[model samples]
Target: MARLPSGTAIELYESLDSTSLEAKRRAERGVAEPRWIVALAQTAGYGRRGRQWEQSIGDFAGTLLFAPEGASDNLGQLSFIVALALAQSLDEYLHEDQIRLKWPNDVMLNGAKCAGILLENLGQYLAIGIGVNLVNAPKGLAYPTTRLLDFIKDVPTPDSFCARLDHHFWALYRIWRQAGFGEIKERWLERAIGIGTEITVRLPNETLSGIFEGLDDSGALILRSDLGKRMITAGEVFFGPQP
Candidate 1:
């Protein structure tokens, strides 16, 4: 195994349903922070709003566990922090300006979804699950999907990719823990997609159409509509057309 820059420990698996579930189980058994669980393949995976993340062959699925100081009390914004870390890591392998953050936890490349993030709490620790489209992508998905090989041409192996992510994530997490979400907010805004564009937000209760203003420090999407400004913490955002 390649050594990570931040001395993070990695647990690699051949296959699993969800790395997040495995990481949470480890956390319950007293696993500490800076630990990662990576799987070469996943039989089942999940995305935002309980959507199933279709895992194709030769893709990347992993979960990074963190037990920050007072993590139980400051768990709300951890997901955004992890998203920010992924965005930065992706920048290294691709053009920096091509990677964009989509609200809560999605990384979009050139307006197509390239990666997704999911976070879960394990009482005392937090697990951030990430799935990157490396070699294969689901066909005819609702949203456009892309693979890293499509852009990188010669993509790295799963092990090398995870090691690089561990290094970049640790560096970003250090800044996040020290400076809070303010810094992340600014960076995310810089690479945000659909900002100032009219979009449809599908909420469980009702559908709202508004201009994508940006995100708040709490990682909520700030939408400006005829009814005035609204902060959305969770919802499905459709950019050009509704599906």
Candidate 2:
């Protein structure tokens, strides 16, 4: 609705299968400028590992398609950046203490998930897709979920919320582009959950349990285990005691 940051373009879809898919299509079509593709509704949205991401009509689903900087190895850091931005944008309504970020990109509200960030790495372009439960949350999910309206008296419309999100995202992005993830990592850790606590991380082949140490410089998870410390680049982390 409001003017986006300089040179940024946005496309609002009444309905789309997925914003990330549209991001890929735009990249393939030789669109190089930075853009935001937001879908008011998704027929078949997906999260990490292709898990279905359900979005109610009032929920938020959008992806920023842009050429990413840094080597492929370092691009994962952007997930933390996006998470930070999301948390900050929601900070306006939620109390400062109500927000916590799970490793990589999950935004926790009152110890439960209220938002998620999924990064789709296209060869030349990176799609930073974000979804937020602005008004209503799905039930029967594996994990606990909450919505912004439940906690705050006023819930922003999806358009205004995304505009606010754009403000925070670009501000943090500029810092990341200049100073790297050092500052970003610190802010993330401040809002991160499960730090210095026991958690389970499930990899493709095996699962491991360990103390949740702070992140490494490059943003790989620093996990301390009986076997010794390990660096995990990617995995699903579960907090609290695991059976």
Candidate 3:
């Protein structure tokens, strides 16, 4: 509809170094139309903080190259939008309550991680990279992990999932553009995990222990720790004392 951004298209590849990398390449070459750069598998995929993200065949590996006209400053909010949209898309195949959104950019199914999102801000372009465990999940991760086939009787293929994800993403994108982040914060909190509970936040220099209060208007975390309530714009979170 007119609510969604124009000039957006999907470019599917058999394999790539990384969809996000491809988006950056396209941007470098001045290919400016918004697009979904997707790969069946990635050779050099990455997660938050440049950790290697291994992609197995049959999983969802894609990046959305979105050009936000007036959103260069408030780009952090897009992660919550992506999380909400991802949860909504996956909810179609399972009970809605089974899907939960983690702060920043992770999707939980049955209380285990099933998907993660990585955002890259490139001037006017934002490359939203996402990986979902469709058929199987990797082992030996610090936290628990899950997959779609674990719950769905018939899991959707990557291409099929892409269509659904695109549909839901645009829906939220419309709401965000029209109604603003108050509505987004409300919706995200409805499906959010660990609100009003104790959690750990891992920063680059140090870690902080706090109670997960909620998100502020700017999408930064509001943690209530011994140091009192403070806003944390960037950090990794844990639900319990680990380490």
Best by lDDT: 2
> Mind giving the per-residue lDDT tens digits that candidate 3 earns over 1-243?
112233458888899999999999988776546688889989999999998887788899999987875567787888998998899899889889999998888999999999999999977678899999998798999889999998877988887788888888888888889888899999999999999888999899999988899989999999998789989999989997667
Worst 10 residues of 2 by lDDT: 1-10
lDDT of 1 by residue, 121-164 (tens): 76667778889898986788888988888888778667677877
TM-score of each: 0.91, 0.96, 0.95
Which pairs clash in the backbone of model 2? none
Q: By how many angstroms RMSD does model 1 differ from the true structure?
A: 2.0
Which stretches in model 3 have alpha-carbon errors above 4 Å?
1-7
Q: What is the C-alpha lDDT of each candidate?
A: 0.79, 0.88, 0.87
Q: Report the C-alpha lDDT of model 2 over 1-243, residue by residue, as the tens digit.
A: 324755577788899999999898898897757888988999989999999998988888999999977778888999998898899899898777999999877999998899999998888999998999987888998899999988877788777788788888888989998998899999999988999999999999999999999999999999999899999999999987789
- Tell me model 3's lDDT, rounded to 2 decimals: 0.87
For lDDT, candidate 1 versus 2, the one ahead is: 2
Model 2 residue-pair collision total: 0
